[model samples]
Target chain A: MPTSLAPVSIDELKAIAKRIRAHIVEMVYEAQSGHPGGSLSAVELGVALYWNHLRVDPANPDDPDRDRFILSKGHATPFYYAVLAERGYFSTELLKGFRKLGSPLQGHPSMKALPGVEMSGGSLGQGLSFAIGHALAGRLEGREFRCWVMLGDGELNEGQVWEAAMAVPHFGLGERVIALVDRNGIQNDGFADQIMRTNPPAMFAGFGWKVIECDGHDMAAVDAALAEAERPDERPRVVVAHTVKGKGVSFMENNPGFHGKAPTREQVELALTEIAEGLA
Target chain B: MTQAASAAATREAYPYALIELVEQGVDVVAIDADLSVSTMGYQFGEKYPERWYTVGVAEQNMVGIAAGLAACGKTAFIASFAVFLPGRCFDQLRTSVAQPRGGLNVKCVASHGGITVGEDGMSAQAIEDLALATSLVPFDVVVPADFESAKQAIVAVGKTTRPAYVRTGRPKVPAVYGPDYRFELGKATVLRTGTDVTLVACGVMVRAALEAAELLAGEGVSARVLDMATVKPVDRESVIAAARETGAVVTAEEHQTTGGLGTAVARVLAETVPVPMSFVGVDRYGTSGKWDELLTYFDLTPARVAAAAREAISRKR
Candidate 1:
């Protein structure tokens, strides 16, 4: 069982987000293969969940009663792995092993390989269903622990995501499962709007989810959206955290090219400097 | 020789197995993809309404939800047509269930396996399910030959911790085993003993193999009949023994010759004792016809098996 830590201040969380962003830039740069833009965009959301909201113990990750978090948008693994490491699930030093051979931290999150990883993911549109599974299982076991899953805006293009979207509410797990869509508009090819247009808020609402919108990078807003998810409702809740694709680094910000490509070593140095200065 | 009074469909035994599992105080959950009636999931659903979930034509979600339920400590049994469950939702099975390495206890009970699905034709028949399922490293594949074995397989999955894929047929085939029959995972049951050739079969074709062995006995050819129900982690000991003892092998199934029981046996024989072998299965897609007619059309009959067995024997060194 994880002992509850004292509540972390929003400012402290913001500082932590900056550090997570720096780590993300460095890890992706060292591997020379990863998605940095989406990882940077999800920094604050991951920070908020791991630092303050999620009820999990790094030591006892398999605790049946612990809250579950699944990175359904698995390409943004730098954000997910950084948060787990920062939360003390594993060594922060292992971040350098991202996508390397024999590393537990693969390009995608693998539940079997990593301890804190609640589910293995890489293929999009599959995470929500996994979260629904955990939520339903929790309900069956009469456990109060909630399940939180994150989805990429472009990943919603998968028909399976909507299949899970329809199932969550039909199963009446509104109160138990909370979904977050990193509403970063860029995809691998180009802008999500240019490739495929999906109005997430309206679509989730249409699928019977209680929809909430927040500025993903804003610490307070992200926290508030997650707090609102705590309320027990008959319908599942979805937080559409609108954010920039490349949030911290000026060069990568809103850039589709950074969606999957890693930054050069010099670019990493500049991005680190920009993230460090952003804390000021 | 006497046969049982009536044939039993392994599909019919599925519901009763679920009822028994629930009565045994097993913490089981059943999930279906709108094919609950055809898959017989309604039997468990009616008895344990709270534990049953109908995912409504979404086989992918059905499999994913079942993986989740299994992850959270419920023994989840997911049911759909054999083709759709393993064929459509294979990724979920690979990543969420099998790859997790005992993280989830999900039983994939796929009904209507192989060309025996009858008039529904090639589209509905899961002739290659065994091959698809066996490809997954951690999944245990079982094609129960009769109602008793199907019931036992379900109960075994409930008690075990690993992920399993149990294939059941739509048609009612003759009962191959009695109530006293025990199902050991990854082990083959040798129904008859012989010396000249071996006939290995699974699912509906187990009966055909037995009849083929009898037909071979009339021609002074001693044929061995081994029912290899578990296809994934195949019973190597039995398969090797049959190969070494018989010198020739004939594998039969109500599936494609490439990836089902035939391939499983061939793999074992190729790696261990190389032998002259023939396969009695559908090498091509089946057409719309009566179940028995389709079997004949595919050359999956006792006559075919007997002929294959003779050919295999003649080719022996």
Candidate 2:
């Protein structure tokens, strides 16, 4: 049994990632309207952060010193909800109610609707700025809480994201904030390069952020990168996690059609079976 | 009416009021989009450097950051030109600020609210801000009538947990409220009372409504002047009562004829009393000129308000 203070091993983290992917497919299949591709792409990143680094207590979620995790790419709520539940923030029973009326499980993460959500997010590119706010407030109050925000590679197209990228270093809040970018390489319309070539590592470096490139699916590499990110630095860090769009499922890999489309009954069975086999 | 002794821009009182909030032991954080000087946010920044943030001309980022700060249990106040606030970052306000049920104590105080932002051309003016702000769910919109009211309005919103939008103007205007006057969030102040016509006005137009009431008095037309400081959740009881008593109504504002104070008052009147009404506001885009000159050019004047009152009263029979 992994205690709260005990570190989760890389193999256990990988097993947890597979379960998260399975939950994503099942939840999206239940909702019949959710973004599965981005959610699947970010499963490993969520697992690594929640299982290893975040100093959060599910019983006392409103702890002022607890590290905040913002889903900047808000459409990936299934990934966020799964990880949060697995961490004991809420019961996994809520997963079936994703995007349903009067459910805490909204299509996008609503901070007010759930106990552990750090931001009420849906419209893209605003989450990083909000993370900066959390960091700034923590700095002023002399709190050591860190802010970890996850961003979609496709969401880098928004001008507001760049604005936040520029302001974090100027405020000297670089060390207090960590941005995780899931480089899925596919947006809603087509390939991310065709929509906008945001070479994130180069772009974030230009904005004076410390950039780290890692293979997202590899649990050990992601854990190592996150650990390295916690090292004292004068600049904000961006971990560009290179990931397949529809990770863990064969047919949906790098497929743009699965970006926001619901999987058919047969596809759901196949995807869940594939995710379950990954755990085996 | 309070003595119009000296004139001061409503924007001048904003920063001082922000400082007062901190002095009162509120955890206040202020952010500006590189318009601290123009928006008068520099005074607060000067006093509280630790809690001040300048986002360097990025209005969208300023709003998003303000939401984040508010989420962390701070009363985050964001300021910019009225155009840039609801103008440039409407989506940020809708999603990040207004949509949050909890952790949404963001006070978006926009300076240069209307066509009074003259000499800077149409781009700087925010004639539709009140409309845009009032459209959002649970946003308490306050358009202060003068310097005293502006300060009091800021302090009122600073002390509350609800998300609010308070608008201030660039040009200096005569003081309408005294130092002792208290500003309620969703209530209107009756500046003058009469029986024939009720003139409802907001922001700088409250003074115009008062002046119109005086003019109407001269022509044997008794006009009731209502200072509708809060544009959203507009003083419905006052509006309904005035419509029922006066039988005629005229709405005045330094905003567009559509979806402003006029629209707010009209909704109340149509629902309850259904009085004859006329709207006195700008229907065309503003042109470059002096601040007061633009008010006259856009027909947002005392004479125009008085004329609108006569039209509504004439149609009452």
| DockQ of model 1 vs. true complex | 0.73
Number of the predicted model whose TM-score against the real structure is largest: 2
Write the residue-wise lDDT of candidate 2 on B1-317 in tens digits: 35545789999999889988899998999999899999989888888888788889899999898998898899999999999889899999999998887439999999998999999999888888988999888788999988989998999999999899999999888888776788898999988998999999998899989999999999999999999999988999999989989999999888888988899999987888998999988777878999988988888889999998999998987
**Candidate 1, B1-317: lDDT as tens digits:** 25556587898778888889888988888998999899999988888898898989888888778888887778899999998989998888888887775546899999999998999988998888888888877788899999999998888877888888999989877788876799988889999999999999999889999999999999999999999998878899999999999999999988878877888889988999999999888878878999989888888889999999999998987
In candidate 1, the residue pairs with backbone N, CA or C atoms under 3 Å apart (3 or more residues apart, or in different chains) clash, namely: A174-A235, A174-A236
lDDT of 1 by residue, A51-113 (tens): 778989888889999988988998899998998898899999999999999999999888758
Model 1 chain B: weakest 10-residue lDDT segment is B1-10
CA lDDT, candidate 2, residue B124: 87
| Candidate lDDT values, in order | 0.88, 0.89
Q: Give candidate 2 regions above 4 Å deviation.
A: A1-5, B1-5
Docking class of 2: high
Mind giving the per-residue lDDT tens digits that candidate 2 earns over A1-280?
A: 1223468999899889988898888998899989989999998888989989887888888988888898999999888999988889889998989999989898988875888998888899999999998888888888888899999999999999999999989988877889999999999898999988889999999999999889998889999998888787888899999999989888889999999988989999999888888832
Q: Top lDDT: which candidate number?
A: 2
